[model samples]
Target: MSVLLESRVNGANLYRRGKVRDVYEAGGDKLVIVASDRLSAFDVVLPTPIPDKGKVLTKLSSFWFGKTEKIVPNHVITTDLRRFPKAFRDVRSLNGRAVLVKHCERINIECVARGYISGSAWTEYKALGTVAGETLPAALLESEQLPEPIFTPATKAESGHDQNITRAQLAGLIGTDLARELQRLTLELYRFAHDYAASKGLILADTKFEFGFHDGKLVVIDEVLTPDSSRYWDAEVYRPGAAPASFDKQYVRDFLVQSGWNKEPPAPPLPPEVVRGTSERYRECYRRLVGKALS
Candidate 1:
């Protein structure tokens, strides 16, 4: 299977090469973001690439962007290559992986919402009975649905892992009003998605979002609700007291942990089965959520 581990457009200046995406400057106020097959785990980019993974992410993000535009404005301009600049249009590999978007001054915060207890939230809850330093109801089981979704903000680190902050810390950093507004938006979006996912027979356990100020208006930016950015599970199989089989990168993380590689730089390459399984899961997520196969 073919995979685009990186992308290059002769006429477009490279803007930023993130862990899984390549960004390009596409003339004034516009940018071309290309998702790549590169997968990262424990803050390290792995050597093997998941086939067509980039397209799944790009397609899923575009679908959600269209679906949620009424709920919130986003930075998407077009996913159609013909609408892109000549240079981007010249690359056939970028067809389903690249997006044209309006440039924005990014807000340096990671807005997260959790409808179910899992991951670091479950970790924190087990240890301190608190998540993001906010106390929760006692005896919450692992993967148990919360009474209501809660907003947990984190710093968008320039390097390494993002540090979770308390609501008060967020208010102090970005001002109380702005912080409150971010929380409101995060929970509202999560609730909408969680309900929608349930109708599709999946549980949106938790997700994170990035926002930026475009023309002085805050809009959702980067990927939204894709498997890469959210924890999704089979609703029928979901159970409390343990993590369910997720349709996300958690499988890769599980493999790495079981191998005892010691989470550090220079991660190991994924085996053929691991790569194939991950690719299938990502595609399955797209199929289930969009109610159609990704073209």
Candidate 2:
């Protein structure tokens, strides 16, 4: 399988290189997003590119954007190659791995929703008996379902880790009214996606959403519920006290944690087996959630 570690579109002006997606400034208000096969673990982009990973991310995000559009407006312009400009359509490598979206001013907040106690939230709970400054009921085991989903927002850091902040701080940063509006949209989208995943025999442990303003209205932007942005667990094998089997990047994360490499730049290259395993897990997620194999 061919892998696009980096994109080189002929006519597009390259601007931003996100962890996974390459953002190119197309003419006017349009942006060409190329989802590279780059995999970022521990917030570090690994040297190896996973085969078909970028296609999976682009396809899965398109699948989800279709499902949740009624929940909120989104920045998607069109994924149809025929609809894209010639500069993008002429590049055959961009097929199924790129999207043209309307550019909008980002809200600069990571709106996260946790349906289960796990990940960084679990770490925070173990230390301070709270998740994001909100105290939780005592004796909650790891991976246990929260009494109810909580809207936890974090700073949208350009580099390194994003800091978990309180709702009050979120309001202070992005106005009280917009903060409340984003909180409402985030939880609604999460619950809707969570229930859908449950019916498909998967658990959406937690997920982060990004939003931006387009034409004076808040709209969902960037990637939606892909493996990189969400924690997906197998529902059949889920247990409250232990980490459940996941079909997301957890496979890569566990390997990196045990590989004895310091979590910093100059990250070690992933072994072939690790690369293949991670690729399969990402494909499995698209198959399960989208109900079809990635094209």
Candidate 3:
């Protein structure tokens, strides 16, 4: 909640602008990743700022990086803003929301791990009668829990939306061995974190993880378990028969769905109260998960 100037160093070349993040080539196999204030709901960024939302994501990612280091290597070089060169050091004052990470040739698949049925997994279950590439056992309800964790990989599109691909298709894209490794690691990481979150009174419904190759070694890159990349539900309200209240962007998405925006072209702006409520929910999630107040 500190007042800081919003600016970036001049030397870094802009890499790719994602829906919510801006990637910059920081020269010499390194990238400066910046999480923007943009809030996306129903595949569209709302036209209002959610205060401290970026900081909450950064904090959550940092926490998970530290927690999951034993599962896989990560690309984080430094989260301390002062360690950056003078030109880019000002970004530090913006709170520890930006990170300078070692850049690697990115894998084109979004590795998603789910322990519960919801979101696209629930939709797919209703449509194809299966989760990921495997068919579910008979008698699974809409929000029913999966028999076990599953790896649901999707193709990382260059622009627009990413397309979901089957395990066989993923094997074609990244070879059977590496594809299998991705699936294995993704579900293992999710299980570890999901159990940890449950103990803390939060439900980690699902999360998306990205990995890249660094010198023939696969390392987890980009953000890890931020609210934008994961769904969190209150454990007290989680029930098998009902869709539980979520702690992430579900607030914004629910509001947008009620607005009847068509989810295309010019998205409608969010009301001030909605922005404030959403921001508080993110903060609450971080505090409950990390067991510490944001610095």
Structure candidate 1, residue pairs in collision: none
Residue 129 lDDT in candidate 1 = 95
Model 2 per-residue lDDT tens digits across residues 1-295: 6699998988778989988899988778999899999989888999999999999989899999999999998999988877887777878888999889999999889999999999899999999999999999999999999999999999989988999999999999989999999999999999999999998999999999999988898899999999889999989899999988677777788888998889988888888998899899999989988898888
Query: Model 3 over residues 1-295: C-alpha lDDT tens digits?
Result: 5322233557766787776777777768887777777777656666776777778877789889999989999988887878754557765444567888888878989999988889888888778888776788776765567878888899887667788888999999889999999999999899999999999998888899999988888999988888888888888877886688787888888888899889986788879898788888988999999898877
- Per-residue error for 215 in candidate 1, Å, reads 1.0
TM-scores, in order shown?
Answer: 0.98, 0.98, 0.94
Lowest lDDT block of 10, candidate 1: 1-10
Q: Which structure among the candidates has the greatest lDDT?
A: 1
Ranking by TM-score: 1, 2, 3
What are the lDDT scores of the predictions, listed in order?
Answer: 0.93, 0.91, 0.81
Candidates 2 and 3 compared by lDDT, better number: 2
Colliding pairs, model 3? none
